[model samples]
Target: MRLIRGMAGAVLLAGTGLAVHPAHAQQPGFHRHDVLQHDLSVPGREVVQVRVDFDPGAVSVKHSHPGEEIAYVLEGTLEYEIEGKPPVTLQAGQGLFIPAGANHVARNVGKGKASELATYVVRKGRPIFVVAD
Candidate 1:
């Protein structure tokens, strides 16, 4: 049902990361689902992928990840506000990169539900979702 290979290659080109603050991990109609996990050739490194869905008008609040993330839009539009950088808005089939430890918020800017394929290259055994403000 899946192809595990090449995920690391995707991560190599994917460095942007984003997360939802703990308080809003389950905000109304907002959801995150782990898609898969694969161990990287680098010792103590791993790749984790998740599918995050946002309802219209839903906002992630400021948050961060334990490592780099490459968020590719799967549907709808999302606006990303990352610390120290201008806010970026992405549409379906587009993507945005968020650096590790960067505080950011991902909001559903479209009238319909928005979602992303958030893939991360992170340290083994570390939580991908980290608290942020």
Candidate 2:
């Protein structure tokens, strides 16, 4: 199981290009809603679930998670890039996993809005996300 916290920031690039920027980049047409959160049986561990929605052309700035992240696409297409890896296109019913502390970005490459369900398993008392430098 995974969990999420709060809004940190996002980087909005024009397309598939990768450009580093400050955390306060232009706002993208993206939204995140908390689905569930609870403490794990393991001490100092927690799980969070969230639904992320992206309008066409929306892009998230480079960032890292406090723990492991797993995402499943529900609608449209998404271009997901992790540091040192090629961008992968995920469509409906597809899923991906990201390890803790790996910089990554996500964009809505399809013509319409895209949505995904993300789960996080992280240490308690830590922010769910951190903006990468």
Q: What is the lDDT of residue 121 in candidate 1?
A: 85
How would you encode candidate 2's per-residue C-alpha lDDT over 1-133 as one tens digit per residue?
Answer: 1211122353331221122222443355976665778889999988888788898998886788789999999999999999999999999999999999999999999999999998889888776667676
RMSD per candidate (Å) reads 10.7, 8.7
Q: Estimate each model's TM-score.
A: 0.78, 0.81
Instruction: Name the TM-score of candidate 2.
Output: 0.81
Q: Which stretches of candidate 1 lie over 4 Å from their true place?
A: 1-25
Worst 10 residues of 1 by lDDT: 1-10
Deviating ranges (above 4 Å) for candidate 2: 1-27
Instruction: Give the winner by lDDT.
Output: 2
Q: Give Cα-based local distance difference scores for all models.
A: 0.72, 0.76
lDDT of 1 by residue, 52-132 (tens): 788899876455677898999999999999898888999999988888888777888899999999888888776565535
Q: What does the lDDT read for residue 55 in candidate 1?
A: 87
